[model samples]
Target: MIIVGKVIPFVNRKRELSSLNNFFNSDRAELIVIYGRRRIGKTELIKEAIKGQKAAYFFVEQALEKDNLDSFKEIISKTIDNPLIAKADFTWEELFQQIAKEEKLIIILDEFPNLITENKTLLSKFQKIWDEILKNTTIKLILCGSSISMMESYLLDHKSPLYGRRTGQLFIMPLKAGYILDFGVDSIEDAIRVFGITDGIPEYIKDVCYRLNSGERLEEVFQQDKVLFAEAEVLIKSELRDPTRYFKILKAIAFGNTKFGEIANYTEFPAPTVSKYLSNLINLHIVNESYPVLVDKERTRNRRYHLSDNYFDFYFRFIYPNKSEIISTDRISGFEADYNRYLGRIFEKVSEEFLKLNTDMLPFRFNRKGRWWFRDKEIDIVALNDNTREILFVECKWSSLNQNDVKHILELLKQKSGHLRWNNDNRIEHFGIIAKKIQDKETFRAQGFVAFDLDDF
Candidate 1:
């Protein structure tokens, strides 16, 4: 057997795919709805699950209704091993009815939103057909689409024709940290660094690996390829009508504006208009809104927003904006220069997110986790354990930590602790400082503060 590379089959979705299979192995037919943003591996998952089975695959195009119906009919006829239907003309209803009457028939309507757009009454007609004929039959109908809004509107929403008809809806997302080891990426920090850049979308991760060997840097591979330069644009342009506005909003978030008002001001759009766009963006899972921890200030303008997906965050931050500079110069050198300039900041943020992921291993889960400011003084991290009433104060320094760094963090904690009045009789406060490389480990240990070096992971 001449295998090219390791076939990482359905690398991390064993449980999800198994559950979906279990559901399909039931008495009657099932209506499964699967969707996600473009290139997030929806089709791959479905195809892998339905491999070697009696499955009909129809990828609906943005075309005329009659043409789409013809295409769908062709797939259905071919799937059933019917050679004669290549010359036969069948309407959508008749073809679907024939499929419904069969056993173990799986029909996948990919890009269903485009089909619905091509013909406005397709879902209503589908609902009528399902109610009258297909519902009682044994045809497993799987509808798939990339347009998050359109998919939700047509099937998942209350005001849609196919609402409440779906047996299961699967929103496929990118891979997370838990799957890093399975993908053959070593070390949690290294895995997180990859996630920071590639964002765990399988296609993006595979692309990164295709160019970069196991020990190679992403900036090297990403800068050499113009394909990655316009990747973010390609993803959004396919689904969104006006890419510029969404791009501006995304860039604003990537540039470090976390609140709606901040993003609007930075992007120079009106607040209400920005809000509407944000709603649409969040609905598509491109961006997310987060309320402050330990605070119920959601309605009082305290809810911050960011790109929910990590890959886009990396793209907007480094690749998309720096495309010309990267491609037009000595790719590796230019990339290294830019990377060295900003990698410290990126690592700090990654370390913070890592801490969130490993809270189970921590001494306490803090109710509040964020940076705090008072005039010129700033604290990098503050987490209060509401349950245990213990406080965790952390300071992250990219360079080697010095006496000044320790003194600064201690001063900030002293100031804030008194103001908040959060001390019990126990007064068990845990202070921690993280560095890219630790300095004076004995001194750090003497101070009863946890110090983490970048190599610790």
Candidate 2:
């Protein structure tokens, strides 16, 4: 079982932490909304932000509404040194009014969606409370939840009752690849391996770090009973009601059926059904649809669907297919070659992140970056500035490349660039390569090409 509150080192959320603290220090009342997928460190960031403050945190459980209210009252009573709060029976509005009596208070209702799910009327009720009672007070009311759809529909949507009432909203995202180094991994490659498995989710990274520091092999982290093995199913089931169909569609994409017709054929589902399911997955941020770089997504039919979360990508690609054998044998083996090929795709993602962080390596700062392809010709990484007509093409290889290999790959990249019709006449083109290791990388850099390796990471 995964342990809670294990004291993993918080790596990097400097901007988010600063934003929350600013809300805390504000003189007026604050209604903040915090949300993301499960185990993406929403709660940890809040805990860090409210470290020594006068805050009452209540994790709204999947229980009765009265039970959650009582729990909230108990927490607030203890936190604010008011025994009267626990003794008095009050509604959510009354409870907030009682809490608002204290100066500069922070009231956190985590899993706020659970409360709304149990009692749908709470949305308008809370809206009334905010407008009538809490708006004039100094209480910082925070509503956080893991249910992205529910949160967006009830709190953020324009037609919702709580619309236009929030002082600020934070949609927390996963950490980037570079932050993996802070987890005590020995090298950049090790960090990438961890990133491929954990997808920069802080809790999963902590679990992997704990296991690795305890002398366990990284492969052992994927054992049948481990949290990582079953996390994808839990996330999907929590978000989607009919998860079986979604699973088939996700597996289809995982197994290389990315096109609309390809997924429909593989799953044997109708085109419209596949479209609806893919839309749901896209909304949850579990899958992403992409067109070639510089192509308008709406105007193009040449789009492909891919898993957005790295852990989900790795899980569906490897674990879901061989789950029975892994469960029976209690180990994973004989997939190193295939796993390395999977890492090649992951390396492309890492290269994109690296280029974004180190944009000075490019000719001019790029405003757009993505994979580009036309017919059978594909460029791994592409960055462009529409205004300046500066474009960058990069090839990412998960294996080592010698001088000759780099030269050959650059030649192919240049040939493929001819197919791109963005600004063929006036576009200033640049080329580069990122790999596991590049021989004489400085030589390529001296030739005015962006060159990077694991050493640079």
Candidate 3:
């Protein structure tokens, strides 16, 4: 029988899988660190890499230190083949010694941060064991962690025991816009909306499409299922200790509190504490610090925070507020309400991201562009050239672009140019409009601004 919504056994990670395979096949033993937000498929990727190969895998559990040691011993015992280690009361050093006996063994320590919590001395123990034993052995060690904050502390921080010991570091990011084609969601618009909404987190995307393929709309799937309703909570609870603080911080950002003061005010947390928390949130990949497109330095007014993960943004904006209604039988109505409330904004964000991706894919373009602003006015896109010192200002309107729309964007671009200090210093050649379907492209061109339609990308 088919296991519906199963991960389909690690499809489409050629680069990552090859990288690991190459390392394993190389002359020297390697220690690799793989990290990402929860459900971005780090564990699965590692598992897939070592599936057919001779390997020892340990998935740390949230238990006491002794239990964790026992669990690890069990996993090693199952894979180790030799009867010697099957019942040996060995230290971590002795364990690595036994693992080293293999010609080319792959050792994966998964959820490494959780294991560190149970045994505060684990990293130091591992570090000592690695330097004295494992590093010189033929065993390849893969340390994977979901807690970026803790992972960095253990493996990256200068003061930590494992610091400066890793041979390779790989920060596995969310799937890019190009990856959707691999997943068979080909339509650019549909891909952008789905990708932006789910932010390429494999599990969330799988959940969404699983529901959609099962004949459910975006709204109905999320609203009608308690399983889906708890997704945001599950995501938050995975990495954070006090999830309430993170929940409040996420809600604040979702509601458009980009500034630290705004987030502080919303969460009722002090500014310094909020600053620390935001740093942690960024480390965890839940939120990001967004800046003006042209700003060279980070400042209070230029910085804004947005949810880095697409699924979190969609969940908070649409699912979280209407959770009670969504988890009920009237979920269709709840979804309709959420759709009406968010579909417009979500559509706008998706359109802009589509342009961004398209711009990046364009060849020979030294500087790809997007929009920026200061106080009063905002821009849709801003393109700059390094050699020529020229700027291409663009305005993206998601909806139909009529004469009135053209005029409004033209006026906005004009305002943006006036506010900038470099308008006269840098050569300004063109202003453009990006839209779904321009009713009057010629009319806008005649009005002295180039018009780009949906197919421009």
Best by lDDT: 2
Where does candidate 1 stray beyond 4 Å? 1-9, 82-87, 181-184, 187-190, 214-217, 223-225, 330-360, 364-429, 433-457
Winner by TM-score: 2
Model 3 scores a TM of 0.84
Model 3, CA-based lDDT? 0.72
lDDT of 1 by residue, 271-378 (tens): 888988888888778888765444456455557787877778877877767767777872534554665544555565666766787787456776668754443455
List the candidates ranked by TM-score, beginning with the highest: 2, 3, 1
Q: Which stretches of candidate 3 lie over 4 Å from their true place?
A: 1-15, 51-53, 63-80, 184-186, 224-226, 264-273, 298-301, 328-364, 368-370, 402-404, 440-457
342-426: candidate 2 lDDT, tens digit per residue:
8888899999998999887677999999999888899999999989999999999999999999999999999999998998999
Candidate 2 stretches with Cα past 4 Å from truth are 1-7
Better of 2 and 3 by lDDT: 2
lDDT for model 1, please: 0.72
Query: Which structure is stronger by TM-score: 1 or 3?
Result: 3
**Residue-by-residue lDDT tens digits, candidate 3, 269-382:** 988889888888887778877666767754445777888866787777767766676656545455446544444455455556655666543222436464577776777566
User: Which structure is stronger by TM-score: 2 or 3?
Assistant: 2
C-alpha RMSD of candidate 1: 4.4
> Against the true structure, what is each candidate's TM-score?
0.81, 0.96, 0.84
